[model samples]
Target: METILKIENLTKDFGRIRALNNVSFTIEKGNVYGILGPNGSGKSTTLGIILNVVNKTSGNFTWFDGKTSTHDALKKVGAIIERPNFYPYMTAQQNLELVCKIKGISKNIIDEKLEAVNLLEWKNYKFSSYSLGMKQRLAIASALLNDPEILILDEPTNGLDPQGIHEIRSIIKKIAKTGTTILLASHLLDEVEKVCSHAVIIRKGVMLYAGPVDEMSATNGIIEAKTEEISLEELAVALEKSPQISSANVDFDKVVAKLNTEVSATEINKFLISQGIVVSYFEKRLPSLEQQFLELTNNK
Candidate 1:
């Protein structure tokens, strides 16, 4: 795949505070890249610089095929930073029409963009009357007005209910399937895990980890086991002594063990039985993005 964006030694400052410090990464075409960090962690600041909405204190960035910032390169991108604003009196369609005019887009593309966000039916409804989800969909419609190849969204699901979150997530996935590269900036770990193919975790404006989501999850191994009325504490103590085990903890009725590497579930079961512990259920725990995020950011 081709590189869509690149940043080297990027730095931004706000008076005495450093917002981004020597942060660098590459975004590939046709992939959904997630930018994750805690509050005030510079995730939004980085996106702002990329969109040319904010200037960096130092360093350099290039976009689309590694071209330096230019009108031609920026024309291929679309973004919504923070909450989207619209005319409350105007309908969804009217609002999008206004966007089209600003972008010099032909009026014919209005319905096409609205349909991309599944808001075609609500296009005639007043923006003030639209629900939160509907407003978000319209925001997306505005971003898609130019049919950009690269899309950037910051906290796209913020303040949305469960169903609204689900709906917006589905729309994003569908857009990605069409070969549009997406950069999603969010603090929600679960949302990143569900939609992003790769991720870059930042903390205090520094890059902690950047790679495929699956590869990061595979680094920490976990095993869960349930025994037939056996003492979980005793089992944890025994597992901790095993050469393959890195750490062990007893949580309620389950014995959870962190392993040095991948191990077969059957091998664990047999080993426990040989030690006079009757195993009822056993399974390898898949590392969650949330757990990885907590470990990485907390350690920094």
Candidate 2:
């Protein structure tokens, strides 16, 4: 994969307070990369530095493909950091037109951008008349005005209803399908799991994990088992005695266990059978991005 951006030991400070601490990572072209962390974890600060909207007290970064922090490089990127600023009385089309004018894009691209975000029908609706979801789409439309190679969004789905979240997620998917690199900063774990191919998880102004989302999940293992005759208590005890089992818990009728290492489904099944326990069903649970996230952030 081609590298589109690289950060080497990037650091930022505000007097005595540090906003970022020696952060380093790379974003590849055509990838949906997520910056995930709790509030006050430097997610917004990191994006601001990358976009050159904030000054870094120390360290440096490079944008590839002839893109830098200069006007030439910034022109290749579009971003919405924090809440979007727009005229409340302006129609959606009018708002987008204003952005187009600012970016020096042809007026001909306004409708196309609105259509790209499925806002063409509502183009004439006042910004204040639009719902949170519609407003977010308009913000995205404004970002797309210049057909930027990369799109960076901070909390794109924040404060949205479930339906609105879904709408924005779908639009992001469609955009990524067109081969544009997307860098999203969000606290919503499920949204990142769904839309991002890779992620960088930060905490306390430090980078904790950065890599393919799938690979991060695969670092841990999960298993689910069901038994017809065995009591949940017995299942828990049985799992606790297994040398490979790292953690085990029973919920309702299911027994879920985390393993010290990846084990074959057949091996687990056989192990349960050899314990004189009838196995009704046994399967390995794939680790979710949520699970991986908790493991990374919650670790001491």
- Local distance difference test, per candidate? 0.84, 0.84
- After superposition, the stretches of candidate 1 with alpha carbons farther than 4 Å from their true spots are 66-72, 217-220, 250-255
Candidate 2, residues 1-300: lDDT per residue as tens digits?
788788889999988899899999998988999999999999999888878789988888887854554555776778988787789999988887777777777889888888888899998989998877888888999888888879999999888888988888898888888989999999888988888999999998999989898887544477778888878778878877788888888856788888888687777667787898886767797777877888788883
- What's the C-alpha lDDT at position 40 in model 1? 90
Cα lDDT, model 2, residue 82:
72
Candidate 2 is scored at a TM of 0.89
C-alpha-based local distance difference test score of model 1 = 0.84
The TM-scores, one per candidate, come to: 0.91, 0.89
Superposed Cα deviation of residue 57, candidate 1 (Å):
0.7
Clashing pairs in 2: none
